[model samples]
Target: MNQLNRTTANIQTIRPIKVIQFGTGNFLRGFTDWIIDMLNEKTGFNADIQMVQVHGKRPATEVEKQEGLFHVITRGYQQGKIIDETRLITCVRGAVNPYLDYEGFLALGENPDLEWILSNTTEAGIYVDESDIDPSQPPASFPGKLTALLYRRYCKGGELLNKALHILPCELIEANGQKLKECVNAYADRWKLPDGFVAWHSRQVHYYNTLVDRIVPGYPSDEAAEIQQRLGYCDELMVVAEPFHFWAIEGPEYLKELFPTGQLGLNVLVVPDLAPYRTRKVRILNGAHTTIVPLAYLKGLRIVKEAVDDPFIGTFLQDALHSEIIPSMDMDPSGLEQFAQDVLDRFKNPFIRHQLSAIALNSVSKFRVRVLPSLIGYIRKEGKLPPCLITSLAALLVFYRGRYKGEPLPINDTEEVMAYFSDIWKSGEPYELVPRVLAMVPFWGLDLNQYPGLSNAVIREVRALLDEEKVWLV
Candidate 1:
């Protein structure tokens, strides 16, 4: 398959598109669709992909041109070995545009075989909208569109309310599908889509809150031309991903029988609770990521791979996770340490050169969510700031400077966080600036100015990290 260079290969067996995917991005094709193919291959429970673009006019038209054929290149450490694997993904039969093809969207419900609804429209995809009620051409919001399709299905199928589809949303938000269902129900009540119809949907559709983890670096434009030459075919939707993957769906135990990822060795799980899993990622993995970005990038590194590869920076990241983030977390420290180690290893994956600037996106919020709690928790527990974490905080503040050595640096973040910190930068000296920034009660959730030692510690470290380019013992 690698030598052939043919990006698209016809699946010898055609399974009806039983799963309606709300996203057609590289992440879905590489992560979820890849898992579905493996399930089909091993357990003979074949599922086909019917992708619905999340938004815009170009998406539906753009995806359809490819005839739903795409590639998934997994580049990372797999089972203790460095692996670079590519597959011609075949699960998607076609992508439908709800904007232009609403009847086509609703008509899928008429298919008795339809059982699953999967989505990874990113966190931004789910929104509450009060407009667009034409059953013939669904609305813009995912919940509204889904409700419209479902309502039309209810009318067509004599309201077989018990015929619920297992909907698993893979967005990163809390209670993803539950929130989505709430949005849909809001629309149902607002538009008066009917009492019985709402009952059927409420009863039948099993909306599972899911947690998915994977790093899908989609459409390698910089490497596309050379990659295409290597592959021999030009694929418009070719996506590259990490060897790691996870999908923890929160629902009844019986739901596992329907998804069946264990038999296939895929990391996808139907768990009773995702809190522990969420914390593991939030505190450990995401925590480490946020902690390292500024410290490593400001030290003249470009990507995560480099950040982890450099001895001083890498050791700082490892120490921060173990000494600070893990201890602060409620999960088993040993378990978190292992997970953090794996995350660091993944960061060093030579095949996938993950850009640090990409991770630097919205870093203020990233630090606030991923690193701040750990900082506060560890401070209360140990009575002082953690070692390398302080380094990251200092580095993060220094990073928002928008310049280093007179060269303009790219610092991507939400306007509010950026603007908030930007005001601090102009407040003057590096010493006073630290406290001024930390005083954002909403940012830190408390008066950081009150923490006398902690404020001074941050100021001292920020000046040191900027000077030495390393946070450890100088």
Candidate 2:
């Protein structure tokens, strides 16, 4: 079989490098790169990407070897149909590891056609690294590297108004673009960069907070040989993803024209504010995951699809989403319902075996972010505790006990969190544990016991869970 290279793959056309991507991960390839390739094929966008390695010391050898050619196989259920389609994505011109050749990485900023910067360097990637004070060398952080690159562009353009770049960071953190911009400004301040450069950056560069959703399970190692045989080529960088995708960008109206993925009938929305969308995702999609995991895992379910397919767990998830989570959201009811449906469909995807243990990692923090908002919101609106959410909370506490039905539960979290749960479970009293856990301010950031009837409701559910040995779906 031929290696999946430009020459072997018969990909002769090369587009201009208009996009500089920060991460060469599965998500970017399966989501952003796929979208760009569609735009190029469908809308005459005529653009390619230059990928930069952010964290790794080594280069993307597969990408470099293949000349940035790979296949994206989108497999899932959509609209009552099984969607399994593959596309050859050739939009990535090449990759550059900044750690290896900092000058070559910086040289990308000097490209006149470079108009956009996209990144998915994980949540922790967007931070202020105080050690990266020296601008002469490659900075230690993502923001620092971006600052150096932008400074080079600012210098090269010499006050040219068209030189400003549009930055869209797809990190899962809230207000990602604003946070990244803040980090870059902090870097400038720390390094004592010129006021003019800062002014140019503020005026010229556009940072848009974005929400991206897609399940890109990269490198199907088990199916690699079979997939290669089917395609009659060897592609080491092949990425597997679901058919559903969404990118909500909070930016000016001009962004619709600038990057017209929406025109391709893709779920790319340019909105004035991303707050409602973010809240919708948190309360519905993520809330469902966090709520279902503990109960389902306790019931001997291992994967997300298995949990969602089981009658009991599936009903619990649906009830929680429609009855508790969606009602708590402030968005349009119809829109919320549709989003919930989409989330359920994604969860039911058979191609992705999302591990319950993987989702259970850092579950304390996950609950605080994904489930607590809905719980608080429901209480605020209806003046009563949401039954499903409270029940899920009970399940979560029991799950933290680290043993379920004589089997060791896969509980992954901080040492402090683990020790706290371990110490509490030693008492072996649900009645006493419920209120005490609620009152711990370090865990919840506020005393959840302060909410009227909240602690009592949790205690009631916890008692039921301990005594009944099954989730009492409200």
Candidate 3:
């Protein structure tokens, strides 16, 4: 028997219905679609997931050629031991490029079978400018495109309010579903769509604020050959992620009855609020990443696995997250600690080699969003600056020094910050720069001088690191 072509060997043989998914990239295939496949297997949900490309740049021809078949390789801790599981996820019935197939994309709304519209268009996908959204193209922004589709659906269904989709926005921002809903309303007004249609949309559609967590490191291109050989089969859409995953939805309990995500043992939930979960994860896991990355990488660790595997670096990071990071969070401490532990475990997963460089993307914005808040929170809560996060801030300044472990770091920062650091560091009085940098009110929103001893603390640690110059990183 030919193993690859065997029908029973595949997992996505479910009856094709309709699920218009935005962003058909590896993250979705490996993360959301993987869970959908499992739900199908366990709950007998006849689901059809049709993905549409969010951007026009990525060529969809090759991806379409793969015939919607993919493999998800899950590896990490299971019952205190390492386990790797390979599951063929075959639920993607078809894929459409909204940028290329504008007609087809709009027509998806007309399909009465289309039940849900799921999206993971990243942090920037929700905001849609009606003017920029080429009427020809499915609109530039995710919300604009979605709004256009919803309008069409309303018209096509003739006020069939029942066909409105349950929107699950898997974006990174807080209140993503709510934001999307707001944008849809904005589009209706901007495009001058009929009032009945807008009112009908208001009545028909439902959007839930969601929080999805999974270490979808995405495609394992470098290890694809090895993975394929180990599995004794080939998969074009193979995704490697840690075993730990979470999906939190903010909505009524009846939503679960419709989606049935929990039937498959998924961590999916329908809660009154996802805010607490979001706060906990963002502060601990995301805060740890931003805080640890610059420090660890500057100390010479390349990948997250190494950063966590090495005794000193790993222990340092773990301490920082648990002691400093978790304590700073306003959420329940015990629950936050548990979540942090799971996050650490996910970081240590052998399956995903999460690169430090990749994590370092948009470091300036990252520090502002993920780390700075923790530092401020720690000070507010404990009446003193947290050591680890403060140290991480010092590390960030050092990392921005435009050099890294005998290699050019290619440091990217705003011209203002770069010039400020450059002008200050050149002042011959080098050690004073640390205090000056800390005292720089414009850099941080609040004055560091008000922090009692924060400047001295940062200056002392940064100077100590520079003076000793020993690589404490993994």
- Output the better candidate (1/3) by lDDT: 1
- Candidate 1 Cα deviation (angstroms), residue 108: 0.9
Collision count of model 2: 0
lDDT of 3 at 250: 93
RMSD of each: 3.4, 2.6, 3.2
TM-score of each: 0.90, 0.95, 0.89
Off by over 4 Å in 1: 1-10, 58-66, 78-80, 133-136, 158-160, 222-234, 413-423, 426-430, 466-474
Q: After superposition, how far is residue 208 of candidate 1 from its true place, in Å?
A: 0.6
Give the clashing residue pairs of candidate 2, or none: none
Lowest lDDT 10-residue stretch of candidate 1? 1-10
Q: Rate residue 374 of model 2 by lDDT.
A: 90
Residue 309 lDDT in model 3?
84
TM-score for model 3? 0.89
1 or 2: which has the higher lDDT?
2
TM-score for model 2?
Answer: 0.95
lDDT of 3 by residue, 225-337 (tens): 88877767665667887788888999998888888987777777789988788877777888888888888887778888789888877888888887777777777788777
The candidate that achieves the highest lDDT relative to the unseen native structure: 2
Taking the tens digit of each residue's C-alpha lDDT, what string does model 1 give over 76-130?
Answer: 8754789788887777778887767667777877767788999887797787764
Select the stronger candidate by TM-score from 1 and 3: 1
Instruction: By TM-score, rank the candidates, best first.
Output: 2, 1, 3
What residue pairs clash in candidate 3, if any at all?
Answer: 12-90
Model 1: how far is 158 from its true place, Å?
4.7
The candidate scoring highest on TM-score is 2
